[model samples]
Target: MYVAVKGGEKAIDAAHAWLAEERRGPEDVAELSVDQIKGQLKLAVNRVMAEGSLYDPDLAALAIKQARGDLIEAIFLIRAYRTTLPRFGGSEPVDTEAMACDRRVSATFKDAPGGQVLGPTFDYTHRLLDFKLAADGEVPSAPERAEAPETKPHIMSFLDREDLIQPEPEGAETPPDLTREPLELPAARPLRLQSLTRGDEGFILGMAYSTQRGYARNHAFVAELRIGACAVEMGIPELGFAIELGEVELTECETVNQFQGSKTEPPQFTRGYGLVFGMCERKAISMALVDRALRWKELGEDNVGAPAQDEEFVLYHADNIQATGFLEHIKLPHYVDFQSELELIRKLRREAMGQVRQEAAE
Candidate 1:
C-alpha cells in the first residue's frame, strides 16, 4: 500500500509543474502582476479576503494569480495560508457610525441625513456591456470627489430616536472567535454573524433570496447601506492605551423589519444588521436578511421550517473550505472503500437471484 501510494509521487510532481506552466498561459501575453490584481481586480480580492477571513489584498491578489483567476481557488489558497500566521491581539470594534462615507444610500428615507451619496454605484446604469472595455487600453477619466470626506451617523439611530425601532443591547464584551473555537449548536448572534460574513457570497445571496421568495420572509427593508473607510485601533496591554492600526473599507447594511408587538409591549420595528469587508454591498444586504431570518426564535416569531432559519444547517455548510474539502475528497483514491461496496452489492444481487429462483420453484 505504501509503495503503491509512493509510486504516484513523480506523476503528482510533474502534474503540479504542468499546472504552474498552464497558469502562466501564452508566453506572448504580458503576465498579470500581483499589483494589477490588487488594484484593478479589487472586488475579486475583496471576495477572497472576506471568504478567506483574511484582510491582505496583496496576498489575495497573488493567490488569484497563482490560481489562474479562479476566485474559489484563490480563496482556498488564502485560507490555507492564514493558518500559518501568528495570532496577534484582536483589534477594537470598528466604529461604522463614524465611517468616512464613500457610498451611502437609504431605501426607507429619501432625504436622509448627510444626503444620499451615490459613490461609484451601478444602480441606475444599464445592464448592457460597454464595448470600450473590450477594446482595452482606454483610460477612463478619474472620478472627482464631490466634496471632502467626512464621518456620517447611521440611519438606524434616526428610527431609534423616535423609539420606533427595537433597541440593541450590547452582547458579551469578548465575543467568541469562530476560528479558534469549534462551533457550538444554537450559536449566538455573534458567531452566526461571523459565519455569515466569512460565508460564500453565492450561498448567502441564495439563502437571502429564498427568504424573499416566501421562505420565512422577514419583510426586510434596507434602512441604510454605507460603504466607506473606518479606522482600526487596538489596545496595547503594555502601554495601557490604544493606537490606530489602519483604515479598512467596509460596507454596512441595516435593515428595519416588520413591526413586532406583543400583549405586554407596544409595537416596534425589528432590525437586521450586516457589516462586511470592503464594498460588498450585495453580500452585506443579503447577510442582513439572512440574519433576520435566522433570528426567528429569538424575536418571538414562529419557526416556519425555512432553510435560512436553521442555524445548524447554515453555519455547518456555509464554510466553503469545509464544503469543498469534503466534496473534493470523492475524486481522491478510494480503491479499498469502493471494492468493499462493490463486493457487497454483488453479494446482495446474488442473494436476490437465488431467492427469485427459490420462489419460482415453490
Candidate 2:
C-alpha cells in the first residue's frame, strides 16, 4: 500500500527553526559576539577568508557561528555573500618587497640582510595541552619593542645579488580573475597561485606531504616565509592616479628547489612560489611545492605522473565547497532513480528465468 507523502514544507521549516535554536543554544546563555568569534577563532576566520575569497573577519565569524562551526559551510556562505558584492576597480599588485612585514624568516639562510623575525608562530610551542587554558586564563605579555620603520627589506635581495633566484618581472598585463571567469588550462602564474591559495587546505597539505614521501621530490628548502600587510591601491581612470583602497594580511612562501640544468643551460637553483591571503604559511608552502611540481612540463623535466604535477586533478578537486556539496548531495532523495534501477533489475531477472525454463523444457 502506497501512502501519499505530505507536510514536507512544514517539516523543513520546523527543522530549520530547531537548527537555528541549536546553533544559538540556550536563550539564557550569552550569544556569540562577532568580535569575540573573530578574535578568539582567528584561525577559523582565516581559513574561511582564504577559501571564501573574502577577507572580512566579522563576516567570516558570523558565517562560522551561523553554520555551527562547519568551516566548509561557512566558506560557502561567505562565497555566496561575496558574489553579490559589486565589483570595484582592480588593485595594483601589492609589492611584497615593500610590505610592512610583521614576520619574516628564511630556512635557506642562517642570517640574511633583513634579520629573521619569528613573529607569532606555533612552531616553537610544545604540543602538550595546556590545562591553564581550560579556565579563562590570560597569557603573560613579553617585553615590547619600540615601533620601527614602516617597511622592512626582503631577505631574497641577498640571493638576488648573486643572481641565484629568478627575478620577478614587471608586467602591465592584468591577471585573470578565477571567480568571474571559468578556470582554463595552461593558466598563468598569478591565476594558478590564486586557485591554490583558496584551495582545500587539507588536500594541499596532503599533496605537499606526498612530495616529501617521494612523489616528485625536488629537495625543497624554505627560501623565505613572510607575513605582513600590504596596501591595496586602485587607479581612478578619470583621474589617472591610483588611490589606497585598503590593506590585507598576506603570507608569502618561496622555496628553493633542486635545479635541473640541461647541457645547453647553465646550472642554477630554481624557485617554487606561493602567495595567499591572511596568515596561512602552511597553505602557502604547500601551494608553492605544488606550483613547482606542476611546472615540470614547462621546465622540460620528465613527466613523473605525480598528483601534484597533474593540474587537472589538483585544480579540479581543490575547492572543498564544490567537492563537499556534490558529495553530500547524494544524501538527498534519489528514490525515483533508485526505484527505476530496481524495476530494471527485477525485469531482467524474470526474463532470464523464463528463458532458462524454456531451454530446460526443450
Those runs of model 1 whose alpha carbons end farther than 4 Å from true positions after fitting are: 1-4, 143-151, 263-265
Assess candidate 2 and give its TM-score to the true structure. Answer: 0.92
**Which tens-of-lDDT digit does each residue in 303-354 have in candidate 2?**
7888888888888889898899999999977777778889999999999999
lDDT (10s digit) by residue, model 1, range 1-362:
22244468889899999999999999999998999999998999999998988988899999999999988888899999999999878998999888988899999999887889899887999999889888886787967856655546788898999999989869998899899999998999999999999998999999999999999988899999999889999998889999998999999999999956754446889889898998898999999999999987777788889999999988899889889989999998888778889999999999999999999999
Give the clashing pairs for model 1.
none
- Give the per-residue Cα lDDT of candidate 1 at 153: 74
**Number of clashes in model 1?**
0
Output the lDDT of residue 165, model 1.
Answer: 91
Give residue 50's error in model 2 in angstroms: 0.7
The residue-level lDDT of candidate 2 at 355 comes to: 100
